[model samples]
Target: MLSRRHFTAALALATGLSVSGLALPALAQTDIKLTLDWRFEGPAAGFLLAQDNGYFADEGLNVTIDVGNGSVEAIPRVATGAYQLGFGDINSLIKFLDEDPSQPVKAVMMVYDKPVFSVVGRRSLGITEDPKSLEGKKLGAPPPDGAFAQWPAFKEVAGIDDSAITLESIGFPVREPMLASGDVDGVFGFAFSVILNLKANGVPEDDIVPLLFADHGLNLYGNAIMVNEAFAEENPEAVKGFLRALAKGFADAVADPGAGAAAVLARNEILDINTETERLEMANEMNIKTPYVVENGFGGIDEARLAASIETLKISMGLQGNVTAADIFDAQFLPPAEERMLP
Candidate 1:
């Protein structure tokens, strides 16, 4: 015969409960602050899904994600420790590392295998489907845009004469509006964003022509998940766990993009679900779910291709620093292929 306290303890153990009749406490979750390359739009659905679906919590991580202005802004924010992780342009990260060579930031996960960089133009503005249609025409581009930052590379690869085209520096908010109003012949931007924004501004889809840089000659990788190198060095397991959760989120988003877009809408009530759904679907099919990604799995890059991209940037952008692909990307944190593969 056991005493009352001993009996209660035996019962608690048998029931997988504590002496106080409560479940055991869970492990402490690691907190992470993350930032995105742009607003809570379609492509941001995966990260949002990871947060809302408890994927991050499953990895014992408490993540707080914030919308960012652009990839250029995101790089410096992560490097400066303003954010622990971010989604940003890999080319932009390359340039940053070249300039400083000591910035403790590197891309750990490749998101956009096929970049969205493009030059969008209105057909009525004497811009046709040809890459050279903009000769002697004004091209509007936001000064800090990731697509515009790679213009020189695109120009070199496409064999376009720089002297024949006039460059017009435009703010991001006005890029599409100005093109719709015939204020500029063409604008440089992400293909998905420019096409949708043009349509939203009343420009018919048929009237808009997108000259995708990737289709032409630039084989550059686009945005990626960047981590502060210092942070990664100190917390390797946490970084791996983050990527695992992120891969799961992406896999889920690829299966049913509408669910991913809904995840974004849950966070931002001002967004239009129909439009964002379309955008998310477009991004999924065109960028995220490419045949290469489908074949090789997500979050890993081909070294030879990445090296070629670095060489292209060095020549086209007049980069003086001796930077290599190794300096800009670190694949150690990527989840295993079996885990990242899509269903």
Candidate 2:
């Protein structure tokens, strides 16, 4: 007794047709932009993995990772909405806060807690045993943009005359050669990038001792995850999604280094990644050594740690009259331990 029209429509409805009642499937993931602290290299393993393994997509995000010239530009770029997120140092962030309190930036997660900067010195220069030995020695360092700007605090803590050391303005590429050929006593450099590479090149570790900035009162976060006030407020879900994917990437990198190195290499083919041992070591250091990065957990910011960094930044950067940590940083985006899934 069913008419042809009714029969066909009833069959369509029974066959899972759109009966004007059921909801449609969810849409695809959203896209996001993230910036890195340094050029594309092995250090950016976690970020590379997140993109390669579709972690961001899994979290409903499409991530675009941009290479940063340095922390100086990257942090402010994020703070000003040039990018949605940034990875860099706490010192730069503190400096920015001091310069302009209006453009407050907050770290959503920590990456490297340990200070990577160090004073690379030759043993022949009588720079041995500890930082105190560097007193009265002709110490060399990279230019103002280099780590030397933070050396004042270290020198003070080490009991060396602020003027006892001669800080040469040799750029980054010249650091190793200047020290090797005896053009200078040693150089200040990022431990992982310069010092570690030197060691890997058959240079004896004892030949060059790294006076870590952290040991000499230069404790600050390195390679942190930060965002601007506006982006953080308007697009919190996007920020959270990016962080979530990054957290998984970090966890994966620490858990399996072989895969991590591959992830890094995939992002930047120019990296001299031939040394497997060095690459693994770098990954481990980034994950475990830094204070900002949690033990057995994702990166989380600590107020006490931030307070310490604030004081260090003020003294180290000679910004006593310039800025405060509270001026530049906001703690709101800093997810709690529960959110970080810390063990």
Candidate 3:
């Protein structure tokens, strides 16, 4: 007895047609390479959870998630097809597309609805919660850090006078240490990450101050799941299925961050379960489960807000007026809102 695939091949061979013409994709698993914006920390549990629970497998996908150097680094990796999908800052994606509208990449899912971009500083070093406090301050900024990349606009919206402020070039490894040692008054990075790193460096909680760019009226979206435009065009269903699985994964993570952190621990035993769990909870409250997400469900964006964000980018990132919000994000790949609701 010939299997359906063999029968389809036989029929297609006789009919002078391709096997695909005889049968649509059924149980065939598509291969996907996914790049994460950063290390396998607490926030990554959602992606890991989906993989561990076989959500991607159930969706007929063989997905491999890789740790990325930075959120900005994932853009080219996905654009050039070195990876089929990635989690990265959508603001950076906007800049990438603006430089060349023909780039084969676009955001498919909104993970960090409010964004985690922040300038974390220590109050003991003359820094405070007020964005205006950054004036005359020396701040550490990693060149590839997603949060630092938003400085131009962040400074503009936050109304900080950079003429008096100095930016110190630093690496990711030293961002928190530099701030903890008071070598630099503040650092540009994700809010939760910088906070956690400072805590690990022994900075007191009372001294740590995270000034989020979004709260200063940036209104920009944050990290999102981006796809290779070519791959998405070729396998639309696979993309949809991948997003569906991620939605479930994130929901589960939100429902129980302890389990989510456990998933992260399963990946890297060196990580402290307590620290990772706290990290996941912080991400859930600050970036993921925003009022908008709670109301509209997850993995979707507001067209008007996205459009306004592009306007903000004009001043912040110096976009070339080459692409619009619609050009950067495609909501068609997301599952239905009802299916994306968080716990």
Candidate 4:
């Protein structure tokens, strides 16, 4: 019993339309709920910017991005179809699929070309920017943290003997504070995040030392955009369109990080723009704008490297050989290379 105008408006709303003042041609809209690997900090700018800039709408997608607790947690959410898409660690996703090959999720775009996993420690506690320094130290690690999950493989690659190391299963909230109090000598977390947080906690820059796993013989990919298999199967074009929009969003973020930070600030009012801007810049320089990404464009990975990573995971993560690189990633949804280049 709706009028023509009312019906049109309702259709638009149901299809995830961002209503403007003018009338426009009606098109079908697909709803996509995306769960991020962490809070709405600077790293989340690319996804947030795409949504705020109407790139998703341009692709006929009504994308709802939700904040998450951890990258590994996003896997089960996507696998269970609770979220149609997610951003998470591809390493964990590989293990998840190895446990059950039929999980309804697969990584579509590589976000962090360099893994954010690092061992952040204090110089006063005798920790250095060397992996061996961790051998006899007390380290705080959150069990669910993505970086902590890398230890089994990280220790193997870096040849760190844990016999003398003591581990504390601390919660995420207390990680920096504990380190600041010198209750723990070091912690496992993203280098940029941990370094900035330690500084925020009154730790001096000269006292902080970060030893990244990637720089210490771990050649693994990091977080990525993944989609639920069922949803992607039902809407392949929507999947493709989503990736395309994301590429545009990342490109825009790379071009103007301030704008990207503003988008994140819109979602999280409590965060400082300058800090968020710096965090965004770190992610851009350390992860998103790697030499490979800059040279080859963004959102795609080399198949050979992925295969090699899987082989490494077998030793580091104890994979049962149930999954392959192709099983974990599907690159067909990515846009053309030239279209994904950073400005």
Candidate 5:
């Protein structure tokens, strides 16, 4: 008769079981559907890179990425379980959580340390290099725009009288063109998106002045990776693996934004490589690769700063609820500190 150990080993080999007689499950891939906050632009290259490089596959995940109409729209998609994951504005997620505290969606990673919110105006339109210049100017704002949603907060901090400004509701497709054609004196939008879109619409880059909200007393963090609470609860390992793959992709993008942009171009062949590359670089410098992110690593937030942001949001957005930072973000799903460090 064969020894017990040898017999067990033979049984393991015959049944694809462990030596301890535990049946080994097949390596099953988790299916994840991810929605982006916007089109496949420069900033989206990192996710594309992750997909192209098989980062998701390495973690036993099969991720499908879809373009979204806007950052605000992404929150609802994830909250409704239409998407298992999303890249969206954290502020929008906070507002959604306040309105429906039962919604099982929370930000898992901090992608943009500095909010990309800004007011892009033409210097020729009397917008001189000051936030006060926006007073009395006609501003184009998209109703669903993440930046525009925060305008009340911006108005409060910049000390601008709401009555002094004429607000024109415009669609995203025409916001840049309208600004370039002088249809509006200024517009609220993400700096990187608006700047390049304006340039593409024939606006002189020199004439554009971007008044960043972060510079003007908005301590809010920007976009992050948000996950559906139910999906995360059932598949914590999958969630962690998703973040790990995403961080790897981000780190790779930081090392070579050109390569990252190329990955984006592969997905949408109609995009102009040069323009998208510039947009990606701009987003990295002004939003993603901030000093704080460099020091603390990516995929995490500073608790103190996050609390202060909640207080600012409460005052500026006139938010009425007992919502706190914990409700909006759960950093527990983030990858390890070392794995998130930029190259």
Candidate 6:
């Protein structure tokens, strides 16, 4: 468990480095294991690209990247010390903190700054233009994760009746097919997963309409690097080294989106249901949207963004009753990367 004072001290130290020109001394080699948000896909490609390209080793670290079952599972696994770090959404992290403030899970890095979950419907529904058009239509949703919980806001922002849209728990898989075949008027899909699958099945982009949560008001940072609080406390230096190398990997992904897509395909043994072109496009989109690459440079966190997410989770997902941003994340492990000459 991390003390509140300890986190504040770390945040102060982390704030000392300028985003544009921060760097660190070369670190001694160490072994670190990371868990992913899900199985190999364009979304999880950056880690694969970094590992395959020797980015981690170059940073004087040897990392093992494990596939994850889901973001919900990913957070607790890291917090409980099953793994050093895991990829997750801010909502999941907040929920974990709510369950146990003293638990070790803390988000040290932001991966996706923009929320990726979206609602898809046919243009013929007239609901495509305005969110309210779906008044009497059924809206397909998954469980109580970020996507499901945020649907009401997704409808509210569009002036649609919150109750008008029926909540159908479609689970994670089979959501894309459910939307395409008209089994459901609309379903929840991420920019990378749902859109990719639809386009692959020859669903013309114009024929489909997406109501992304980011476009609405659900602006929680998604897909972050979470580490066990205990591990981060005991091995702050190791955590710092991990971020330094990860930033490099992210920069590489942004610089060469095509290579990044290839790395994902190779890692998974095949591309996702989407076409190669769509996969590449999704990769670049997700890369730029990642807060690790956007808000405060790669692998950094924006306190304001985090604060907004904390409120959203509490109001929308019924997360821990009174969790604060400080309770869910610690930025101290992130040193200024500009000064460090990463490998």
> Considering every candidate listed, which one attains the maximal TM-score?
5
Residues 1-343, candidate 3, lDDT per residue (tens digit)?
A: 9999899787776656676545534545799999999999999999999999899999999999999888999999999999999999999999989998999999999999999999999999888878999999999999988998899998888778889999999989888988988899999999988998899999999999999998888899999999999999999999999999999999999999999999998888998899999999999999999999999999999999999999889877788788888999999999999999999
- Candidate 5 per-residue C-alpha lDDT over 103-163 given as tens digits, one digit per residue, 9 for 90 to 100: 9899999999999999999998988767899989999999888999889888898887778
Off by over 4 Å in 6: 1-29, 152-159, 272-277, 286-295, 319-321, 337-343
* Candidate 2 residue-wise lDDT, 1-343, digit = tens: 9998778667666664543565332345566678886666566777887888888887778788988755556777887787878887667677766777667576667777665767878787677757877766666665533356567766766677655766667766666867777677767766666666666555677787777777666666665788876877787777777777777776666666677777777666665665533655674564344443454356765667677777766666666546545554554554455555422
Q: What TM-scores do the predictions have?
A: 0.92, 0.81, 0.92, 0.92, 0.93, 0.81
142-232 in candidate 1: lDDT tens per residue? 8778999999999899988779798999988899999999999999988888899999999999899999899999999999999998899
Clashing pairs in 3: 153-316
Residue 235 local lDDT, model 2: 73
lDDT winner = 3
lDDT of 6 by residue, 1-343 (tens): 7698667655655655332344533435677888886777766656777787887787677798888765667877787788998887667677767877878688887767666767777775554756666677877777634565466556544466666557688867777777777778877656666676776666778878877777766676777788887888788877887877676666666666667667777766666434543565575565444435543465566787788767666665666576787777777877675622222
Q: Provide the overall lDDT of each model, using Cα atoms, as 2-decimal numbers.
A: 0.88, 0.67, 0.92, 0.92, 0.89, 0.69
- Residue 109 of model 6: what lDDT? 76
Candidate 6 C-alpha error for residue 199, in Å: 1.5
The Cα error of candidate 5 at residue 234, in Å, is: 0.3
Residue 129's lDDT in candidate 6: 55
Question: Local error of candidate 3 at 55, Å?
Answer: 0.5
Give the poorly placed runs of model 1, Cα more than 4 Å off: 1-26
TM-score of decoy 6: 0.81
lDDT of 4 at 284: 96
